[model samples]
Target: MNQPHTAQDDGVRQRQQQIAANLRALILSGDLRPGDRVPSTSDLVAEYGVTDKTVQRALAILKAERFVEGQKGRGVFVTTQVPTVVRASHYPVTSSEEPYAWIADNASRGRAGSIVLLHVGEVPAPAQVAAAFDLEIGTPVTVRHQLLSLDGEPVELVWSYYPSNVARGTRLAEARKIRGGTPAVLSELGYPPHHAIDQVSARLATVEEFIALRLPQDMPVLRQLRVVFTDDDRPIEVTVMVKAGQHFEVRYALPKPE
Candidate 1:
């Protein structure tokens, strides 16, 4: 049997929520600007007449939402929000206007962007992935997997899949960072990317992802399914991108209809 709700329980819950709301308001109001240190837990508890645990809980909420981050032996400081353009219909991959799409999107924003090669190998595609590639289920695809970081903090997980035939005997088959970018490699192979289709969705982060991104459990994430095609409309690449929800926003620029 379950116990019924009690006034005492309701009061405690409300108190916790109130503390969180008050701190969130302070941050949003610019009273606590980015990089500004939040009050010590003891200070907040005493000033708000709340328990130490209540103050901690409130801080935890802010941390999970990426509003503030705690440094060991130091104190919590407001975290800077990273503005990311997750999707741009016009910024095709082969634009080759930059070293790589990641660098253009992240490094140009004044944040150090980096990619750490995680895994690269030929793997059998899942049913949906095969369908996307117009191949039989379980067909082999070259998978280039890596982790993306911003300002030394892991923010995104990326995996680019290529048809085995298209990837064989190319630099994409190697487990090393591609020079320039993958688009450059594709162009060298005579099949430059022309345009792409992008789909974005949000979901709770998995345990592995929680550890990878140093994110709180139950925090939502943004997942992108991107397909890059050639001028002739041949799909050449499919990439899966998983990013921290608090760190990104997707925007699509549609061409004005004639």
Candidate 2:
């Protein structure tokens, strides 16, 4: 048997919603511009005469709606209002191309940059990872993981994988030798990927990821997975990127048919 909600409980729920709506209006009205500082959780609790948990609930609602973003050790801020566009196409690498240079260029348009290279090494592929790359179980693969920063703050973490057969015995197999970029090395090996397919989703982070991303205890994350393919339809590489919900935007242009 379920207990019924009392009038007092209903009143509390209504108040929480009202608080969230008020904040939403302020953000949409240009009172809080992009990168503008928002009141701290403690301040919100005091100002609204609400408990800390209630204030956090309201903020969580705002975050899910994409109206605000939070930074580690930094208070929450009004997020830039930008439409997210994702390009679902392939980019062929040339001998002169750099693996992440193109992505870095794209980020530059949004004033973002790569910050940390967490881990890069060859390891036995996990079952799911091997399947994604069309490899047999236990095949060795080279994995390059990194965290990207925007304006000196961490924003996203990226994990890239390549089959050992594609990277083995090549300069790319050595982390130091190809530290500059991956596409350049792949191009040199005659496997220049020309196309990509990307998939996106939203979810909460795991305990380890939460700490690694430095996300707040209750915050969510956005996940993007991309598979790079050659013009001949051969799978060349796979990349998984996780972004803090507030600071990340995906942008692309739709082509008009002639």
Q: Cα miss at 58, model 1 (Å)? A: 2.1
Off by over 4 Å in 1: 1-52, 64-66, 69-78, 90-98
lDDT of 2 at 89: 55
Total backbone clashes of model 2? 7
Q: lDDT of model 2 at residue 251?
A: 57
Q: State the lDDT of candidate 1 residue by residue for 155-193, as single tens digits.
A: 898889999999988999999988677888888998888
TM-score per prediction, in order, is: 0.75, 0.66
What C-alpha lDDT, on a 0 to 100 scale, does residue 84 get in candidate 2? 36
Q: What are the per-residue Cα lDDT tens digits for candidate 2 across 1-258?
A: 533422233454455665677787787666778898887876776667767788778887777666787888987888886423434454433434444664556565776555577777788887757877888877889888777765565667878889877777776666542433777677678887677778878898878667776774455688888888765888788888887765554656578998
lDDT at 99, model 1: 57
lDDT of 1 at 59: 87
Question: Clash pairs of candidate 1?
Answer: none
